[model samples]
Target: MRDLDETDVEILSLLATDARRPFSEIGERVGLSGPAVSDRVTRLEETGVIEGFTVDVDRTKLRGGVPVMVDVDLAVDAGADSDSEPLEAARERLRDANPVEHVFITAEGDLRFYARVEGRTVREWLSGTFEGVPVDDWTVTLVDEVEWTPSIDGVEFALTCAECSNTVDSEGETARIDGEVYHFCCSSCLSRFRDRYQRLEEGA
Candidate 1:
């Protein structure tokens, strides 16, 4: 993996702020031709340096439910590693849990769970998801205030549709073209991707 130069960083900055920014406009500011900038951005996407482009939407304006946090400590069997059979089974159950947005495991093998409170209380989430699961102990805390889709570290989080450049959901359809996977959130995006791929292959 090659380290990004200043030019790459500048390109990322512009795109992160405005995923819809034209390549020509970016080139004008960054002192590069349209094609040059296009090639660099394509390379960045292909290399996974840039995940995807997204828009910032106010969660309060949305109709989704609030967030809740749950902490679960599973029972550890004697003479077993962290990835023991019981833990793996519990993990599988958690994956199928309703409204579970995120789950993180601590160094002590305890789980930190984040879930959506869609007409259900934090205790309800615990009862629904963690019930019947073998656990040493568990606790629930309602997140009174929180930030959804917070910025990653110091960088902005944005994911643009690779085909049409429209801001799309993180959980979208994906396709593998010539061993390179591309994300598409709609049929229009898939059509655009197919057309572009055909053109590129024909030209090649």
Candidate 2:
């Protein structure tokens, strides 16, 4: 991994809080010009420091109550002797599943792959979509609580509201509400923040 400098870390920190925040605003906060901030962000993206910008959607507000994390163990074909070949095949099949949010290949344990599923029920997530797929064993981990912290270069990011300048911390994994970014300490806070932000957006 490439080492990140102080300015790079600060840029990552700010972007994590609100991906949509203009480069000018980020530059103001970090004491750089808009173009300079833009250049840094571009470099980070190219170097893989900033992977991609994504909006965190609220699952509960949609159809599902809460998303479940599923660990799937696949029974590979005996003909496939090499580990890399089997693993790649498993990943390709799993990627076809619509409910699968993320998939990871592991090396240290008996379980070779893990995935996060978002659906109305665990059965629908597993049996309905992944029934015919060859799998030896599977495990489902329902996330009851999550506490997320934004860190860059071994330091936590400082969060502040764009409107109020209130300090905030990662309550959990982020979820998008409409189109704006909001930070919450918990699910309750998330709901409240969404409502307030929506109202503000409407008024403007």
Candidate 3:
């Protein structure tokens, strides 16, 4: 798959706002045609650039609770050659926990994970999970929210406007053609692409 550029970023941003938005509507906003926008979107999904769209369900309504970060300093056995075994085992245990949202390994050699907790399970997970071995220390801190979004900068693209040879910023504006999303610096270039696109369609 090709690298995602500014246009891809913009498309993702638009979708982020409204997942159900029509590709043609997104194209009009970004200066791309419906087919072109649709193609890029498909590419994004195929390449895993766009993981999967999700609905913003109200957690409180579903199951009320507080979100917290669990910081666990894994206790590797003294003189043990590797902690990988214990770490993986612990991760497997956490996987069964429905509250768990994300898990990550920090550079400082600790596991930082986020999960929602309610009633007594919070205390149980905080202690019972790492009781006998493996964890050196652990702490749970309540968090207001958890958001994980990534931005790819200056990602690879076709590089220039098909209309004016102007350099395109994937973040700027866009026009899609034959399923390819084209980025533009402004409306004028996008307009140029739009005009050419209509003619091409009419001719076709």
| lDDT, candidates in the order shown | 0.64, 0.58, 0.65
Q: What C-alpha lDDT, on a 0 to 100 scale, does residue 154 get in candidate 3? A: 48
Worst 10 residues of 2 by lDDT: 55-64
Error of 2 at 75 (Å): 0.8
**Candidate that beats the other on lDDT, 1 or 2, i.e. the better one:** 1
Checking candidate 1 for backbone clashes, the offending pairs are 52-159, 52-160, 53-158, 53-159, 53-160, 54-158, 54-159
Kindly list the per-residue Cα lDDT of model 3 for residues 6-109, writing each as its tens digit.
57665765675578999999899778999999998887777655666642333332233567888877877778898887788778667655456567887765
Ranking by lDDT: 3, 1, 2
Residue 133, model 1, lDDT: 69
Pick out the ten consecutive residues of candidate 3 with the lowest summed lDDT. 55-64
Off by over 4 Å in 1: 1-63, 79-83, 119-125, 148-154, 160-204
Candidate No. with top lDDT: 3
Work out candidate 3's RMSD over C-alphas.
16.5
Clashes of 3: 10
lDDT of 2 by residue, 1-204 (tens): 355555665566567668899999989977899999999888777765566675333334322245566676767677866555545555666556534434565564333333334444666656655566566767877776555466899898866544334456533323445543444333334444667877998999
Top-scoring candidate (TM-score):
1
